[model samples]
Target chain A: MTPTSLNHGASAARPPAAGTFRFAAHTARIPALAGVGFKHTHLDAILADPDPVGFVEVHAENYMGDGGFPHRALERVRQDFPLSLHGVCMSIGGPQPLSEDHLARFKALVDRYEPALVSEHLAWSTHDEVFMNDLLPLPYTEETLNHVCSHIDRMQDVIGRQMLLENPSTYVVFENSTLNETDFIREIVRRTGCGLLLDVNNVFVSATNHGFSPMSYLMDYPMEHVGEIHLAGHAVQEDDEGEPLLIDSHDAPVADSVWDLYSIVIRQSGPIPTLVEWDSDLPDWPILRAEAAAADRILDEAAHSFLMGKSHAVGA
Target chain B: MTKATKTAFSGAVLAGAVAAAISGAQLVTATDAAAANVKCYGVAMAGQNDCAAGPGTTCQGTSTVDYQGNAWKYVEEGSCASMELPGERMGSLEPLERDMPS
Candidate 1:
């Protein structure tokens, strides 16, 4: 069956509060095309020419403050392209209860921008009311799974929408983890009724760091529920054991291997909304735009092959 | 200190506070124009600076250290001198040696 048709928890697991909040009547959905992470520095260039990409994404925390240049620029960008609000510090996987204040601000953004897609990392970053300022890994035990699901449920209820959760790149693994990463994620989706955001670069980084196969991880991933994809660059370093360690640094262009993996996923999944993220040490707008354009080319090819396959099957 | 005298004195204090607030607003307006392109220190909240987060940390949101006086954000050029922060710290034109959250 096609990945789109293999619904894991698409409609059945929505929280009752999902219907409480009303989105704008004209809220647009992100198309099955390539997008780029929206950088404030590229606002002028994007406004000057906004055609190269299908959508733009922003870190939700960056725009959480009261009215300022960030919000103003986002408003301008939202007028032109579909937006994705990617939250970095929700700490959904943390053992603590979700922060009501952070959730309220997140809900406010969802209400204000009405983004086409909303996502957060699977990793936790806060403990004891102190945010660690990084996406820290969590053990994949039954207890942790339950905690993550409850957090996801609360987040969905507060925002009144299903959120996509992105996989993380880890530097270390816990000996107490009862379940593997993919199985853990599958359980979270089964319980929380949320979607998955397949970050191919993250998959590559984690696979390399943990000595797992990226292809094998993708094969086991719950791709049917994937609503979005992320591609970013990583910094390479040596671990304490003198092994290669990859950091999800997002400071450079999409590496060639990541592009290859992204192509494979798109060819199979048939064109999810993919984002090219270059968060630090960013390049010129045209250079970033070129990266998105490259993803678009692959997506276009996948679309053609899918259409042709359907026509041939009908003929048969 | 009779009741009538005290009432008059309190009204004068209120008037002075109001006058000071009005002048402060005017100053802010005038300084706003000249504040462009100035690196103001000891103002950014935790994880909100444009970039840089001391040692052992990389890019944005990596700074768990809140309000590092060394981390400066671009604010209005002339306004940094007037901005007051918690702990009696003032925004500085250059990186500060004080108010580094421990």
Candidate 2:
């Protein structure tokens, strides 16, 4: 279905007033083009040759430390490309209240960098005070919905910007879940006024593990509120029953099927700013650039088709 | 001893502790600047290492064990030898036998 057909309930939530925060005057909004996760090892190569890269993303937790090379490299990257601050450990879906210290650090980074887009996952990572460092899944129910919405509200209120909540790649489904993933995410957008970061590879991975249709999930997603898209590679494993299990391991190239799924999403969503994440087993700059380039081709095709369709409708 | 004499002795010990803390912080900064590229073992907190811990791990935040000796983080070159840990252990250039999961 077209994004226009989706309910725009997210608009009902209050938006931040103008001049609530000041971003760098020179920095532009992230364009509807392909971007890549920023790696420190790639700083030199990126500075030397910045092509086919529309923006760059970095994990928010990684830069939470006080000033150092991480900030230095990010500052350089920001000067050249639009930045997307992706937080991996906010534990937004956890039952406990959000961490005040983590929120303060997140806000500090946002104020310092003024990223074009900011996002976090739908999963939880912290239990009590202990952090698991992995995106753990939560059951979909009214209780969880309330908790997730409260966390997202706090996060946006602190940062003073609309943050995108990304869909997670799950290995298991909760038998007690009352709502499906799409409906759960849609409710989050409706309540929090946050946009969505539709990770197509995650859709593929979860679909493969749980035996569902990724296309159906995409169709049911709140596409109109999608602010960004993430495409990453996952590792293949086996469940106890010997069925295929997928880990959202950002250690390899995007699989062929995932590329196809991404192409489909791009075709439907037009051209949201897409990022290719390769956090581990990093390739040389050129190799990662090629992955971004691959995404660019899909985005380009989608843009071209969209323009053509617009013209055709106008002619009619 | 008289109360005045006991209080004066306590003040001296407290002052010494503060002085040591200040110098220790300065030493870390100085050594960090002087030798910034050394891979100091058993220094990283759990899930906070700069990179992989070992097999089955990928990169940052993948360490399952806290202060895993096998997981090394880059620190000042010579400072690792002086950095102290609990149980009288010190940071090592090579992975230490302590802190590994049994």
Candidate 3:
């Protein structure tokens, strides 16, 4: 499934031992139910009385430094929760060759904290030498497919485990794209043996902004490749043509439509680890716990239904 | 493992252990106090200083320096309030209301 006949040169070398490296089974001690992204504001609460969520996720880029409070806090939570390193700045889908420095930093973090799952965005963040510090969109072209796959392969090889790629919340589309975002992502995963971090809110936002049906996108998405799910809130703006464009803003609660879509996704994919990402304008810890509880109820219902189906089969 | 290798790996494990202990300490602790002396600034493109409060926004007055090592100008509500005041260092910064770009 190599894209464009290009193969990442394989070496027999093992990755440098950075931190406490552990496999998924050891890393994710808890089952992949509902989790929340960790924030600095909630660290004390999380430390005092850990949330009842199944696990927690954090941005790997935030912990790339030597020694700090972020690392200390994460280490505390790691004892009781399965951690997934959801990185925001890897820029795997960028046009330029991957930066070895950034890759080294990622490796160091992975080695230090053996996350249950490691993930990055399916978009670029830098062009030439300018770091835009945003997950810019990528065209679904063959060249990009190859570029992203190579980056993922390099990451997997360096980290000694499979990585997850999250779909981008795009504001603009490239005219030269030959494939839709979903198909391109599927191809990347199929080629690199990576997983997908499906941000359902991003799908709804991008579909609304681009005049597409989010329902259809969900229908066609590869369910098995999804290792985790993200639910967040968005803000919508109308263009001069009076068309609404939704921005993936994590300052609010999950939209009703998104929650409905999430329930449907849970029915389809079973209960995977879901996260409520509130990066900006974070509210009190109680508000976030309530959000996690909502996701927990969905997962609980799904699990109950699953068991009921199994019992029915046994009786039959 | 080589001596150096063992040493580095030991250090990392020790760090991981310390991080773990701190995680335990943080559970019963209060939020750290904010830094007192640190200042925040935003350097935007020159001459487009309509940086005032918009709908659902607030603006503050501050001073900014342009490229080419020029003097600082007092910016009020995203507009230049005072003339370019020259000094060896950038003048005292007045807090400007920055509209959160949604």
Candidate 4:
């Protein structure tokens, strides 16, 4: 949906615990299992059946508006399922300073919903006060790192919650870039004390586009810093020169290779809150649920192994 | 090549590219048409099948084909495009590669 669709629905709610900003202390935690992106198309099915999944995540910008079906339905879903606020428009990595207006809107939503987790991307989508509504890549330089940290700190202050930063899926890289994507992400988390939302599809897409192994990038990433995981679909387009360009289009099923990488990530990170992001070609609720179930299986396996490790340690 | 030859060659190249893309798209469309009969749902698009402006709707029908060169095709009910949503195509990658918005 256009960023404009975010307009005209639901005023932000003050979190139940007023005056205190430490939302994580009381907020229902995102269960370390499979959750699906909440789509308007599936609202009816969700309201009717409320099928069993770990939790549900919604694009924070989508519900920024005031009093519409989105708010009504999302409120109902919130009653039964834990929710995470995922933002697509914060422009945290843009050259210009972060938008206070958007930040205020986000803060209001967080206060109202008290989502289990909150996240924005490490990419920018705005420049010169114009909102492009696309997640543009950032140059991984020392200067950019400082700029992004200031913005993230400001965001955490305004929202009064620990934020999670997701890596952007890139098609091209800057020539003068000094740091790799993993290093950049680690530095951001280190500096801001924010958590990470490691999108496996993004790692695979960026690694493939930039001529690297997805495994190496995952190994290099600070796995302990990750608070959540994202698995989505991508598309490959051939340009005018007949070369394949990978695009992070969340419109299909998670690719097999990405799924494998996700399993590996789970083996390392234990079980983080995982989301199946199908933003465009959203399938029926059952299809999306099936995708979530696949993720659930991975999470269940990982949790079992984790428990086994703990028990063995106790015995020793 | 001279400017005239360059222009002519570019024209031929554009024609070839368009033809190839259309043929490839048509093949995909044909596959969807074949799959349509077995699909259990129907997806409807507004203009282009971009999630931003055209997140589409769930409706019952055989896949609708926009023969007027609009980029949306019904892959399945409750499903629109398999690849990138149309609006996403105009994002950063286009400007970075060609200095023009797609």
Candidate with top lDDT is 1
Question: Per-residue lDDT for A291 in model 3?
Answer: 90
User: TM-score for every candidate vs. truth?
Assistant: 0.74, 0.72, 0.70, 0.69
DockQ of 4: 0.02
Ranked by lDDT, the better of candidates 2 and 3 is 2
For A174-212, candidate 4 gives per-residue lDDT tens digits of 998999887787677666767778899989888877779
Give the CA lDDT, 0 to 100, for residue A238 in model 2.
Answer: 82
Say what the interface RMSD of candidate 1 is.
6.7
Q: Write one digit per residue (lDDT tens) for candidate 3, span A133-216.
A: 667788899999999989988888788876778987888888999998877876776677776788999999888889898888
Q: Please rank every candidate by TM-score, starting with the best.
A: 1, 2, 3, 4
Each model's fraction of native contacts: 0.03, 0.00, 0.00, 0.00
Give the better candidate number (1 or 2) by DockQ: 1
Write model 3 residue lDDT over B1-102, tens digit each, in one string. 544745555887989988876765565533321111111323354333223312111000111223375577855675444433556245776444665333
Top candidate on TM-score is: 1
- Local distance difference test values of all predictions, in order: 0.78, 0.77, 0.70, 0.73
**lDDT at position A106, candidate 2:** 95
Ranking by lDDT: 1, 2, 4, 3
Query: B72 in model 1: Cα distance from truth in Å?
Result: 22
Off by over 4 Å in 3: A1-30, A310-316, B1-102
Q: A40, model 4: CA deviation in Å?
A: 1.4
Find the candidate with the highest DockQ and give its number: 1
